[model samples]
Target chain A: MKIQLALDRLTIEQAVAVTRPVSPYIDWIEVGTSLIKEFGMDSVRALRNAYPDHVIVADMKTFDNAVYEFEMCFSAGADIATVMGAAPLVTIEACMNTAAKAGKKVMIDLLHTSEEQLEALQMYSDAIFCLHVSKDQQEMQGSTQGTEGFYVPPSLSGEGRKLAFAGGITVDMAQALTRIYPHVMIIGSAITKAKDPAAAAKTFYQLKKE
Target chain B: MKIQLALDRLTIEQAVAVTRPVSPYIDWIEVGTSLIKEFGMDSVRALRNAYPDHVIVADMKTFDNAVYEFEMCFSAGADIATVMGAAPLVTIEACMNTAAKAGKKVMIDLLHTSEEQLEALQMYSDAIFCLHVSKDQQEMQGSTQGTEGFYVPPSLSGEGRKLAFAGGITVDMAQALTRIYPHVMIIGSAITKAKDPAAAAKTFYQLKKE
Candidate 1:
């Protein structure tokens, strides 16, 4: 279970600064969707340059034009790029092809997908299937309120899914996920929004025994 | 029936120049998802400046945090920002709230969603629910090949599902969608990738007129 440090809401400079201390502790660094939207492809390039040895994931959560998006991020130096699993199978295939061509990995995000769609896309043996809780909108109304993070045992334990979980994961959730999921889990606000990000990340790493 | 022009795969300079001329003919200028990802929030700012009088829809197909993204795009000078229907219902609500606070509108992209999810989310009446076709994957795939450029109804079109269609529309498809669907239908590469884009756009308009 390699740790993936996701930099959400940090500027390119800040992302670099934050990762310099945490890079060795992290197996991968994610240029979050917010950063991508804020700074564009430059965000990918900068992070890749800063951490040449570390895997860089551009969280594009791409919905359409999958080939173009995957190519753009991969060219800019993303070791991994994400496409929404909720996208058509064609889109998912395009993403896989682009990643294959570039010798990169594709992380399929299962943000709001059905079980049928999940079963339909089970052929992606090489892809990392992520279960994400939307930090921007989780608990705004009735959709799982006041929870530090999501605990999806059914989805997390896929038959062969190379699982990756992301959201507002606290220390307790980190330990729980690490113990049971047997997959790479991601935490955003629990680390990035922390008063002491490095410490929070260190604690998460220690708890996960990574 | 309004004409929406998607400025995709063009440089920002080319986008501005193209948007200026096409603005009169088109009702909405889609700062397409491609432009937003390639150039970032600046895409919205530049497009909004280029066509001050026209409605600028920044294709920020957000799947995660809606508040931060909605605020960023709306502040960057977008009249509308997109949230993926594949996002959680809370995400949709957060986006709607942010839009309301910003005095803007939300276009919920129904990309690769099931009928149940669409039926589940029909409560966001203000959102212009889109029957979007993947700009890259859907067009080239054998299933939808040679069927580009038009609006086809979703498997289920329930109440409050205000429709907008896109996937490689054709002259015939555009003519048919404008006549059949009682909503905004998006026509992308079918018209833009044509040898003569303005003329192609004129064809969609001509069809709507007839």
Candidate 2:
């Protein structure tokens, strides 16, 4: 399991500062949707320049104009970009084609997507499927209330597709989830909002290795 | 009907330059999703500062963290922000509450949303329910292919909900849609991608009046 640090709701400077100390410990550095919306693709470019070796994920949560968005982010230095699972299959296919041509990767975000919707995406074997809980749902209800008991659908897991899990992930939760062995474990506030982000990241790093 | 000029897939400089000439002919200046992704909320601020009298919309297409994204855009000088209609009911409610508190407005982008989804949104009478066609769908197929004959569901129209229409709007299409008397008519590439954007906008402006 690899740890993906999600930098959300932070200014560009704060994101860079927080990641500097923990860059050596994390596998992927995610430029969260809010941060991207706050600072633009420059945030991705800045993070890419700062951590040349680390993979950068732009959490665009793109639902439309997949080709343009994927190309724009990838050219700006994103190694991986995300598309919403709820989007039409054609949109997802466009994103996949863009990623393939650019030699980049796409992570399909499965936030609020139905099981039936998940079945249609099984053919895109090269893409990484992510199980995500929306931040608004978490804020409206409680941390443990949204997407807490999500299971990877049999068709996807059985097909050996790359899988990722996100939302309110804690150190204990990460440890527990490691047994199931997702390709990427995305953690946000648990690290970025921590008193010591670097230490929190280090702990998750250790958990991933275990 | 109000003509909202959508500034999409442009650099901040390009967006500003294009709108400067056509600002007088349009009712609202929209900072499109691509612009927001490429330049952030600062793009909203820049446009707001540049066109103080005009209503500036930040097409955040917010699907989650409604309060945060809405507040960020609104505080930065957006007169209106967008939320995806495909989002959960709780999420939409949260966005409406945020907009109400900020004394701004929310436009619900109904791209990829179903008629069943449209039913749940009728309560947001003040929110503009937009009929959107995804750009990827437009490019993958032909211009006349996607969202070719979209109609406002009677459930929403009967409720006196404010309605808007988008997606590959031409001057002829705009003229046709005007007969329906939509509250807002969103035109994107028809103007922005035109050889002479200001001239294209002027033509649409005349059509809107007719």
Candidate 3:
């Protein structure tokens, strides 16, 4: 399992400062939804420029103009851009094609996607399917399995999609996911809000190394 | 009926310049989602500063920390801010409080919300419930009401909520919406993308005036 540190709430300057120390140990640096909206595509380029070799994931939470939105973000230099799973399948397919053509990746956020909708999308572009529990839901269940524990745990077959989870991921929670899922684990407040973000990230990467 | 001009895909300079000409006739000036994200709470501040007398709206697209988001936009001098209808009921209620306290307004973008969820938000905030069809849908609802409508005209009732509509809104489409519903009509690309944006805005305002 790989660890993706979600940098949120911090100002871009603060995010950059914190990222420097954590980047060596972390595999993915998520330019959060708030950051994307707060700074726009320039921040994606800034992060990409800042860390040329690292994976820069822009959490766009994109809804409409999937092609334009995805193209803009990826062109702005995001290694991966996200499309909402709740977005129309056509939109999802559009983003998938955009990502494929760009040689980048797209993650679908199933924040409130219905199972029937998920089942229907089983054949769409093989993008990473993220099971995100809404941030408002408060204090997610760590033992539930997968990333957010909102969806069924790792069967790891069917769609050839890589799995990622978000929403309130803690250090121990990330560790548990590392042991079981073979999926990418995303941490937001757990690292970004930590008193020592580097040390906290070290704790998660340390779990992966184990 | 009111005409709202959405200033999307422009630098703050372009947005301010565009609004300066159109604000005289327009009821509302929307600093669109793209501008809001590209620039931040500052986007609200800049547009609000430029058009002190006009109803400056910040498309914050509040999804989480609703009160915080609403307050941020309001403090930046927004007379109204948008919240996604897909957001939790609590999130919408939080925005209502912020709007009431700020003496401002909230517009709920019912981009993909179902009838059941819309029914649920009957009380608390008499927000401008927008029937938003995303630009990326690519489904092609042609030029007017009779030209293959993607959605039926929005039904506005229950606690007397106001209605607004958006998604590829043109002068003809704006005229159609004005004729069909005595509600706030949000026209984005129609005015913003016009060869003569101010004239395009004037035409929509003319429809509203009728």
The number of the candidate with the highest DockQ is: 2
Instruction: List each candidate's DockQ score.
Output: 0.66, 0.76, 0.45
Cα deviation of B22 in candidate 3 (Å)? 1.9
Write one digit per residue (lDDT tens) for candidate 3, span B1-210.
877888877788988887777777788889887776666666778888888888887887776656656766777788988887777666777788879888888888887776666677655446888877676653533323232343543445443557777777766666566655645777776666778877877787777667
lDDT tens digits, residue span A129-196, model 3: 77676555553222233343344533435545678877677776676676556467888777777899
Question: Is candidate 2 or 3 superior in DockQ?
Answer: 2
Tell me the tens digit of each residue's lDDT in model 1 across A60-179. 988778888888888889999998888878888889998998899999888777787888777888999887766754445424212343455464456766888776667777776765
DockQ of 1: 0.66
- Tens digits of per-residue lDDT for model 1, B17-108: 76654455677888887888888888889988878888888889888778888999988899988888777777788889999988899988
Which one wins by TM-score: 2 or 3?
Answer: 2
Report lDDT per candidate: 0.77, 0.86, 0.73
Considering chain A alone, what is the TM-score of candidate 3? 0.89
The 10-residue segment of model 1 chain A with minimum total lDDT is A141-150
In model 3, the runs with Cα more than 4 Å from the true position are: A139-150, A153-159, B138-155
